[model samples]
Target: MSKVENSSAESGQVKVPESVVMTVKNFRSASDIDNFYRYINDNRLRREAKMILDTVVKAITPPKRRRRSKRVVH
Candidate 1:
């Protein structure tokens, strides 16, 4: 099994790795650092809101059933 599958099986929740890479030309001032902090905070809030919305959607929606294939006999 893959690492993701094993983790999901053990914890009942999947762990996905997320990242953001950016190159800053002049990242030397206090305001620049503050702006970066605010950006991170905003992203965190958005992610949390998305997770809550997804949970609510899942609770409201029904699970889909898989169709079974029938074998043909000659």
Candidate 2:
């Protein structure tokens, strides 16, 4: 894995493993998806993270789930 050495702290470039890049390219498991979310959540780069979360993460996560109500009366 080629280590991405952060050239500058102010650059807002975080080092990511090659495996992580591969996983993001094609998710293999829930953990892979989780890694994407975690990266967005954990990063101090709010603007970048927000953009990805709003576009990609927002699309993939389930919107909602509803259950039918059941009632019995005498």
Candidate 3:
């Protein structure tokens, strides 16, 4: 079972559709996850998937930062 399995509708929470669950569990890349994210019809399920995707993206992508200029001290 993948991490996606943890977000199943069978858990007795908000019932996410099976198609959505299947899509997520079978995800092989970020684009697959994004497809499911767009496919979910339920608001609650969509939010849950969004949260997971956001976390996944954050974990995989490097953070961007602006470099500061160095100053000489007198």
lDDT of 1: 0.72
Candidate 1 or 3, higher TM-score? Answer: 3
- Runs of candidate 3 exceeding 4 Å displacement: 1-39, 42-44, 65-69
- Once superposed on the true structure, which residue ranges of model 1 sit more than 4 Å away at CA? 1-44
Point to the candidate with the largest TM-score: 3
Residue 66 of model 1: what lDDT?
Answer: 89
Count of clashing residue pairs in every prediction: 0, 0, 0
- In the range 1-74, model 2's lDDT, one tens digit per residue, is 23345453456778677765664446646675678777767886668867866899779989888887888787
Q: How do the candidates rank by lDDT, highest first?
A: 1, 3, 2
Per residue, candidate 1 scores C-alpha lDDT tens digits across 1-74 of 99879979899875655433234654534576778667768777767766877999999999899899999999
lDDT of 3 by residue, 4-72 (tens): 576764575665677566554457556765666557754458677778889999999998997999898
Q: How many backbone clashes does candidate 3 have?
A: 0
Task: Give model 3 RMSD, 1 decimal.
Answer: 13.6
Q: TM-score, each model?
A: 0.37, 0.30, 0.38
Question: What is the alpha-carbon lDDT of model 3 when measured against the actual structure?
Answer: 0.70
Lowest summed lDDT window (length 10), candidate 3 = 21-30
Give stretches of model 2 more than 4 Å off.
1-45
